[model samples]
Target: MAYEAKTKATDSSVLEFIENVESAKKREDAYQLVDIFTEVTGYEAKMWGPSIIGFGTYHYKYASGHEGDAPLAGFSPRKAKISLYFATEDTSREELLQQLGKHEAAKACVYINKVADINVAILKTLISQSVSFLQERYPNHN
Candidate 1:
C-alpha cells in the first residue's frame, strides 16, 4: 500500500474558515497572514485539510521512503497559538527566526500568539525561503 497525505487540499472556503475562527484577534491575524503568504509565495490561499491555510504545494519522499504532499507555507490558528508551517530544513530558517519577534520554534512549527508578536518582514522571508527550499528538494511543486 502507498502512503496517503491527510493534509491534502480541500474544497473549503478559506475566508469562511478564517471567519469561523473563535478568537477575533486570531481571525484577524489569519487574514493578515493570508495576504502576507500570498504576496510572498505568489500563490492563492487554499484550505489544507481542516484548518491549515496553505499557499503552495510540494511532494516529498524522505530517505526512509515515506512520501507525502504538503503546503510550501501555511498556518493554522489553534486555541493555544498560531502554528506556522515552514521548511525547517532550510539553511536560513535559524537566521530568519532570530530576526522574528516573540515566538517559540519547534521541530516543524513556529508558535506565535499573534501576528503582532512577530516581525512581518522576517515572516515573509521565511515563507519565501521555505517555498524555494522545497521546490529545490521536491521539484514537484504544484
Candidate 2:
C-alpha cells in the first residue's frame, strides 16, 4: 500500500487558525510570519494539518519508496513556542540558523519564542533558501 502523510494540506482558513492561537503574542507573530512567508515565497499561506501555516508544496519520494507532499516553507504557533519548518538538508541552513537569533533547532524545525526574538531578514532568507532547495531537489513540484 502507498503511504500517506498525516500532515496534508487542508482547506481550513489560515486567518482563522491564527486568530485561534491561545497566546496573543504568538497570534500576532503568526500574522507577521504569514506576511513574511507569503512575500518571500511568493505563495499564499495554506493550512497544513491542524496547526501549520504553509506556503507552496513539494512532493518527495525517498529511495525506500515512501513519498509525500509537503510545504516548501511553513510554521506553526504552538502554546510554548513557534515552530518554523524548512528544508532540513539545505547546506546553508545551519550557518543561517546561527544568525537567526534566539531559537531552538530540531532536525527540520526551528522553534522560536516569538518573532521579536529573531532577525526577520534571516527568516526571509531561510524561507527563500528552503523553497529554492526543495524546488531544485524536486523539480516536478515547482
TM-score of each: 0.94, 0.96
Residue pairs with backbone overlap in model 1: none
Q: For residues 36-130, write the lDDT of model 1, one tens digit per residue.
A: 99999999999999999999899889998898888999999998999999985646788889999999999898999999989999998888888
Give the Cα error of residue 81 in candidate 2, in Å. 0.3
Q: Which residue runs does candidate 1 get wrong by more than 4 Å?
A: 88-91
Best by TM-score: 2
* Cα lDDT of model 2 by residue, 1-142, tens digit: 8878999999999999999998888988999999999999999999999999999999999999999999999999999899999884546888899999999998989999999999999999999999998999999895
Clash count per candidate: 0, 0
Compute the lDDT of residue 100 as modeled in candidate 2. 91
lDDT values for all models: 0.91, 0.93
Question: Which ten-residue region of model 1 has the weakest summed lDDT?
Answer: 87-96
